[model samples]
Target: MMKRLLLVAGAALMSGLVIAQEPVAPPQVDLEQQQALRDAVSGTSRGITNVMRDAYRNPERTLAFFGVTPQQTVIEIWPGGGWYTEILAPLLREDGKLIAAHFDPESEVAFFRRSRTEFEEKMAGAPDVYDKVELTTLNYDPQLPIAEPGSADRVLTFRNVHNWLSAGEDKAALVFEKFYAALKPGGMLGVVEHQARAGTSLEQMIDSGYVTQTKVRELAEAAGFQLVSVSPVNQNVQDSTDHPEGVWTLPPTLRLGDKDRARYLAIGESDRMTLLFVKPE
Candidate 1:
């Protein structure tokens, strides 16, 4: 609920603006909601492999950290392969809504086209789970907004910051502003992304598929979002963040192909930062 939107300014005020907060506290989840998330996470109907990755992804805690409940209008940006969608689709199926802002199917880029096709097929294949998922795309037109200005309670993006960072900071900032425009007053933008340690250069970040947390903050702040909270629920202490093929060198991607495969599997996924930003009321 937006009821407890305690607007307190953060210390690092920039250009007379400051990050606001609703207080940094662990999100409380009732037994019913907890059980519901667990059920969704453990559901066999979801992609079997996706379920296995919960060890690294921690969907339940991550969503709870974002204060996700069953009664909010949420939009998932670029839900490639619907990894989180498998969990989010059901959690909000009954009382809430999930609008997946995916890639343009009509795009000239082969990768974008394929990604959209696969996601669409996944949704089409799972009618019971995904029939209610409203699909949309961003940046195609100015007149046609992503989620109708100020309509969503939360706009979520997972492991996508690097892709945006690849397109230059100006473009990345604009993308975040699009999200800002999509959210309601006191709405949230939850970003879960592969993280580089502070001071990583933009070029290195883009090349490595990991973004520096500082850059992310700048982009969000530029988009007019207030930093609300950061969660270590997705952090991987084992990851060095200095990989040969970038984050893809880790499991789930494992781009190296037996080039120290066992070692990478042991290290698991890349270290990630889960940040919550608020569109101040």
Candidate 2:
């Protein structure tokens, strides 16, 4: 009996050694594919005006940080003026899908009507670039749906949260719920918004076109998402976040219109927060 027990023990030790000796797989890094995506971002087909914002926007790094790959379905909420649309549509045209969740077309607001017209014209003029692009409508109404539930691999929003907040906190929460519903389990939600100073009141956030990081996370968490990570890829340290016209006082908008235009230009764009959240599997 002792000899049999000894043999079994020896065999168990040998099996453990074999298991330890097995090779571990290395983490995957598709360098060639990544380079190709970066090339598309910098391509001249995007035009000069869009290229000018590349430095401030940091499209390549920002999208990479958000885990935006070339082969996944992505939904972009409120793509005002189609700033990111220009890059996203072309990059995803070959292998992936790009869905633009735009404002409700039936709205009587003149700005919404004109922006929709311009966006359609832009898309129409560039069939080669936007042929596969899909369109969906989003509104502040809680009953309205943004995209099909669990359909998108990723949902992205850029500087549009403040506009939702303008409708009120409940509406903003509903919008987040829609985003959460649109993404597949374990999918991502990437947000880039004007960052308010920490501890700013909700009233200030609503008034100044900025939001605290804490508030954003709380909203996401409340909507059944897990905060995955935050990236400083879009941070602008020079922005003081205290202008009379809120974020519009900065460049691009320059709401003051030559009243300290050079100073604001030196400050550059509004300081922004880039957050990545994931739906739990």
Best by TM-score: 1
Residue-wise C-alpha lDDT for candidate 2, range 163-257, written one tens digit per residue = 88888888889999999999998788999999999999999998999999998998888998877778899999999999999999998999999
Model 2: lDDT of residue 50: 78
lDDT of 1 by residue, 66-132 (tens): 8787888999999989998998898889999999999878878789999999999999998999999
- Evaluated against the true structure, the overall lDDT of model 1 is 0.87
- Measured against the true structure, the TM-scores of the candidates, in listed sequence, are 0.89, 0.88
Residue 52 CA displacement from its true place in model 2, Å = 0.6
**Model 1 residue 268 distance off true place after TM-score fit, in angstroms:** 0.3
Off by over 4 Å in 1: 1-27, 140-143
Off by over 4 Å in 2: 1-29
**Which candidate leads the pack in lDDT?**
1
